[model samples]
Target chain A: MTIKELANQLNMSTTTVSRVLTGQEKKYRISEKTAQRVKDLAKAHQFAPNQIARNLRLQKTNTIGLIIPDISNPFFANLARTIEVALRKRDKMVLLCDTKDETTIEEESITLLLGRKVDGLLVAPVGEKWAHLEKTNNIPMVLIDRYFEHKEIPYITTDNYAGSYDATSFLISQGHHRIACIQGLVHTSANKNRIKGFQKALADHKVDTAQTFILGNDYSVENGYESAKSLLQAAEVPTAIFALNNQIAIGVMKAINEAGLHIPENISLLSFDEQPYFELLSPPLSSIKQPMEEIGIAAVETLFELLENKKVTSSRLKPTLIPRASVKSIVKS
Target chain B: MTIKELANQLNMSTTTVSRVLTGQEKKYRISEKTAQRVKDLAKAHQFAPNQIARNLRLQKTNTIGLIIPDISNPFFANLARTIEVALRKRDKMVLLCDTKDETTIEEESITLLLGRKVDGLLVAPVGEKWAHLEKTNNIPMVLIDRYFEHKEIPYITTDNYAGSYDATSFLISQGHHRIACIQGLVHTSANKNRIKGFQKALADHKVDTAQTFILGNDYSVENGYESAKSLLQAAEVPTAIFALNNQIAIGVMKAINEAGLHIPENISLLSFDEQPYFELLSPPLSSIKQPMEEIGIAAVETLFELLENKKVTSSRLKPTLIPRASVKSIVKS
Candidate 1:
């Protein structure tokens, strides 16, 4: 039923009914008992608020577009789920689009979301390009996971540099000198920061860069397999391998087993973003976990602030390590 | 730019430009050369075809709501990504809403999607309730994975009955007399068919129900762990356990490892729906792999057919067995 109809039937003003329906009764000073009665009657009649008309009136779409690179990867999937859930609580729905890690697809999705006139956008972009995204029609937008700090877009992401550095140092402390590193696109800030973290960890320990191998073509399983295959064929293989993400890490494990090596025994392994299945892996896995829940909450908060014309800055949260049995110690026993 | 402006700039009819932009030129006998020219110009200008305006004119949203039960589960994630990719190819966008396996959430999402004037819906509903879904404002809808035949809704799901039957029979042939069957919502069609298959396989082999244990409260990791824990605590634990899904299977693995039991030796395990990480597990799980790709494609196909007012029937595709090393042969070994 329409709010006006409900208001007339309840012998109450339309403003009072609207306030109660939108859960703004506290501001309107409506009694809790009256609010409860209104809600019970509305539920009985299966009343669903017309968000579309209301959106048009407020010059808002009441819809947010969530663009991710890939949903097959649990990291993106989990993040998307969390964001959608959080948005729902704010009485907003999500339009989901995946770029499949292609910059062109991401651009097209942005255009589509804009044409649909979304009130806001939350994106984990595929690349560093931002000149094109500058025209957001003043709609509130927040970046997630990946971002371009050179641009004014507000973002919430895990500290990739710190996460990768800590993961590398942990392996080195376990007496692993020669380690293999997997990388995504070399130009993206996340990749640059991750590589920096890996290299900085080795530099801090006074290790030579020539001792490590930076491998991979993308953040995918196929890249991991190919990289590990040729690396294992080398006469001097590394003692530990640090994968950038869960998808690639799974691929690395397969390649290791195919080469007849045991985890943390012949070859120690590590990855970022802990997944549920990671724990059930052969030796479990030592990996860095991103603060996804906090990031999801922060992204929404930034978008709401932007909606109010408030300035928002890019923010990064710390990543924690959940060490399992994937790393082995070889400290001169 | 607007279609009219683009048409005027190209010295072509607005209808022709619309047809070319919407990939419908060939239907109107428009020349391929002209269509190509139009497409190239559209790409050059980064034209988005104004889906919102078109939706308003046609009294259609030109958007489909995809309501999935869960996305953390790879099965649904893959299916969703595939569906989204396929839908985008047709110039349609997706509104994603996850019920998180909650009936109330599913109902709320459905109502919200309807109120948003969505032209169609693709839902993998939770629970067996259908009366609430019949009032979708006459919007064309298709079911995915989950189905309700009594509601006259079109659906695409894997052949759970045959898949479960084959798995149970294979375990029986391996000399497994005692098997544990984990189910998700026993009253649901999928669980009912799966349980039916298991019972039929046992009856055919003359194995008594007394030799089996039917457990599990839901299709979750926690349920699987608890069910497996209590089952392992029994004086006579089953020789094999057939988990309902991938998440449950992972939990079963954890419970087995916690109880100091080795896979395929102390207890054989099988599950439905193969995930990428399943192979990386300690023993590499054996699973009944559903035709997720085919189901996703079929789901889109059915939705399009419904959009065209074509009568579509619920269809089922076969599941394949990926026999990894998780199942053991106990026959006279």
Candidate 2:
């Protein structure tokens, strides 16, 4: 029912009814009994004030916008879950915009979220450079899982380089001299750090870095499969392979299986991130596990901090190495 | 900047500015050049007209709400990706709400989506009963990948019973005397249908119904692993195990590996739904492949139809089995 009808039913002026519905009548010293009566009647009638009227009166949507590259990825999905739980604790809600890892879509999502007048934003940018995001900097934002070129923005992410270096060095300690690396998208800082970590491991061992192998592609199981096939077919296959992410690692395992090779027997496999199915794999996978929960918690915490203190903060949490059967000790020449 | 300020700057009336901004001036015989000038000025000023205003004016959000149990599941993720792509092609956007398998959270998401006045909803309900969802008959909804008690609501789902029956029969065709089944959440129609199909297969083959095995749990890889372990340790282990979903099958495979048993050697396995990593397994997993893309496309299509026709329609698609190395013939028995 319309506000006028409710007002007429309550024998109150339309102005008073509007004020009561908008919760402003109390501020104007309307009697508590009258206000309660209006609220009870409105509830009984299942009256919902038009959103436009409510929004216009409150000047706030009470919603936060979340833009992520891919919601289907376990990492991002976990992050989103954590963020949602955290926000729920604070009585706030999220408006999610999945960009599907496309730059144009990312831009469009940002604009749309801004147009919605969300109180704040949490974004995991798809690319390093986002001019649209930079141009529309009016809203508060916290970048999660990935960073942007604009260092002024607050961001929370794992130490990709350290994680990769530790993983690579662990493989080396296991006597895996010849190693292959499957990289994520080359345009991002995360992929670059991983490459640096892999190279550093080879340099520390005084191994001819040229002999060490690297393949760059998007983070997907299909890409992992293709890269693993090419690496295994090389003239001299590496003793161990490091897949940058779990999806790729799964793909690599498939390639190895297709080639009639077994993990750590014919070759070793290691990857970044832990998949729930890892322990279920024939030979449990060895990898560096990023602190997904911590990353999400920290990102939300940072977002709130920025919202409250209006300050920019950046953090990179350390990654932990999870050793499993996938890595095998190589025979030294 | 407000419309008043824009009008002052452009030497026009506030009504004209509002009209041009809302795209109503043209219908009122306002010149095209003036409207263009107003738009260009607004663009230059970077004025974002409040979304609520535009939404109220247009009576549409151009946004569809998508609620799923979990985004990390490859099946749901793939489905979400398809929906996103399909919606994008139609120049529409999706607002994703991940319930993380919590029924309360799912209900809360629906309320929030409704509060936002989304044009329509595409939901994969957590389980069989959703009284809260039923209470809201105002919103047009299309259930995707899940079913509900409310028959009136439109839904798009796979033929779970037929798929399961075909998978179980295939194992019987391989001369499997004893077959086991790993089921999903029993509260879901999908899981119930699969179980019915399994039972039907055993009855058709004249196998002792009491000897037929069934394990029920969430459709996750961990459940698969645990169920496989228990099934293997049983007094009479089945020659073949039919996992109701891919995650469980993956877990079962891992359990087999850990037990130092080879697939199709000590035991054969077949599962419902195809996972990308299935082919990567040592012995490629045999699976019933759901028409995932079709389900996704159909979900959006159904949502649009509901919005346009204001009528509900339920549709179901069939799944096909993809034969792989996981299943082997029982030669002696």
Candidate 3:
């Protein structure tokens, strides 16, 4: 039943009936007896106490929009799961939109989220342009996983640069002079930082780079396979390969198997992002574990602060190196 | 700006302003001149047309709730992804609630979804009780993947029984008389049907069942690993195993690795649910591929039907077998 009918029958104003029915009586200084009377009438009438009606007065939908690149990826999926868990505790629900890593879809998601009147937004954006997001004026928002360069928008991401540098240095220390890196989308901030770290490591070691040193335009399993295939087909194949993410790493592994080569024997390998089946893979994989749960928590907390009109700073968590058996020492190489 | 304020400034009713702004002028029988006038004023005033307030009068939120057991599972993630894509096309957004496979959380999610005035609901239920769901009387809802026995609610799911039976029969055909099954939660309708299908296959083949024929009370990777370990340590270990899902199968794979046994060499395995990394695994796992995308589309269509007050019957789609190298033929044995 509509709140208007209930208000008329109860001989009360619409706001009083709405406030009491929504359990916001105390905030509005509603009398206990009046609240109990309203509750009794609401119960008798089987009234749903329309949340939409309450949202009208408060200008708060108590919902947030979450836009991410791909939910099929384990890391992103786990992050969404964790974020949902965290948000639910605070009486906030998320409307998820997957961009499929497309810029056009990402922009559309922003427009749709605004149209839906979500209280805030949590996004792992696919586009390099930050100006498009500024259109969400006065709507609280926080970025996650990936963001644009020079963007002042608050975001939480893994310290990809440090992790990449350490991983590259680890490979160099293993006596591998020629190490190939399978990277993500060329323009992504995460990839840019990773490239910087990789180059810094090589520069520190005085190792000259080849044209084929960095192989990637995307971060799909297919990209990993193709890049690894090309690397292996080279005149002087690298002794080790570093993948930017788990999806790519899995493809690289399959390519190695298809080529009649074994991991850490003919060539060593490493990857970013912790995969669920890592330990189960034949040789096990040495990888960088992005702190997704932590990132999820941070994103929620930051969004909450924004909702409260509090300023939030961007956050970055360190990725831990989970060394297994994929990368090996090349003492003689 | 509020629709009410914009309506007052334009000397138009709130309904007229809302219809024109939301592009429902034709549907609402508003005059073309009046509609154009409302749009011009809305644009001039920067009136975003708050949907929440309009929802009170229209009795439609343009939002749907999605309740799922877990989002981390690849199947469920893909389903959510597909559903989100489908819903966006119809100008609807989904409020995702992951119940963590708990009955209490599922109930809470339902209550919250109702409180949020969701236009409809799509659920992959966790509990056997139907009483909790009956509370959503006027709100349209459709179940996916799981359902109650006596509930009149429409559902869309994979043909679990037929697929399970076929998977089990394939294992039996490979000359593996001793076969084990790694099932999901025992009480779920999907699991119950799968168990029945597995038993039926064994019975049809005249293969004697052992006390350890079925080993599972959950579908987590940890459960799969533990169950496989126990099965492998048994006095009469099975030559083949049928894992209920990919998560369980991955765990089983890990357990086999820990025991220093190779897939298809010591034991063969066939899993339910198609995994993205199936081909990348050492043995290239064979699997029963549930028609997830089809089911997702069907669920959305069914939900839309319910929203339109149209009757929809339950549907179950067949699963296709994707054979790789994980299952071995023991012709000599």
TM of each candidate vs. truth = 0.88, 0.91, 0.92
Going through the candidates in order, what fraction of the true interface contacts does each contain? 0.68, 0.40, 0.78
Instruction: Quantify all predictions' global Cα lDDT against the true fold.
Output: 0.87, 0.82, 0.87
Error (Å) of candidate 3 at residue B103 is: 1.4
Per-residue alpha-carbon lDDT of candidate 2 for residues B1-333, written as tens digits (9 for 90 to 100) = 678788899999978888888779858878988898899999999887777667767877777888888777778877887888788777676777778777888887877777667788889988846786776646778888888744677899999889988888888888887888988787888898889988898889887877778885888888998999998898998899898887788888888888899898999999899977666566778999999999999988888887788565687799999888889998675
After superposition of all CA atoms, the RMSD between model 2 and the true structure is 2.9
When summed lDDT is taken over every stretch of 10 residues in candidate 3 chain B, the lowest stretch is B45-54
Best candidate (score: DockQ): 3
lDDT of 1: 0.87
**Candidates 1 onward: DockQ, in order:** 0.51, 0.46, 0.67
Give the per-residue lDDT digits (tens) of candidate 3, residues B1-333. Answer: 778888898887887887787889889899999988888877786566556766776878888999998899989999998999899889888889999888899998988889778899999988566677888866888899987767788899998999999988888888888988998888787898888889998899888886338888887999999999999999988889899989999999999988999999999999999977787677888999999999999999999999888888999899988888899999684
Q: Write the per-residue lDDT of candidate 3 for residues A174-201, one digit (tens) a residue.
A: 8877999999887788888888989999
Q: Write the per-residue lDDT of candidate 1 for residues B1-333, one digit (tens) a residue.
A: 778888888889999999998889878989988898888888888777655566646667778899998887788999999999999999888999988888889888998898887879999888567766788877888888878756687889999999999999999999999999987766567787888899999999999889898988678899889899999999999999999888889899989999999998999999988887788888999999999999999999999998998888789999988888899999995
**Stretches of candidate 1 above 4 Å error?**
A1-54, B1-53
The C-alpha stretches of model 3 lying farther than 4 A from their native spots are A2-47, B2-47, B331-333
Interface root mean square deviation for model 3, in Å?
Answer: 1.6
TM-score for model 1?
0.88
Interface RMSD of each: 2.3, 2.6, 1.6
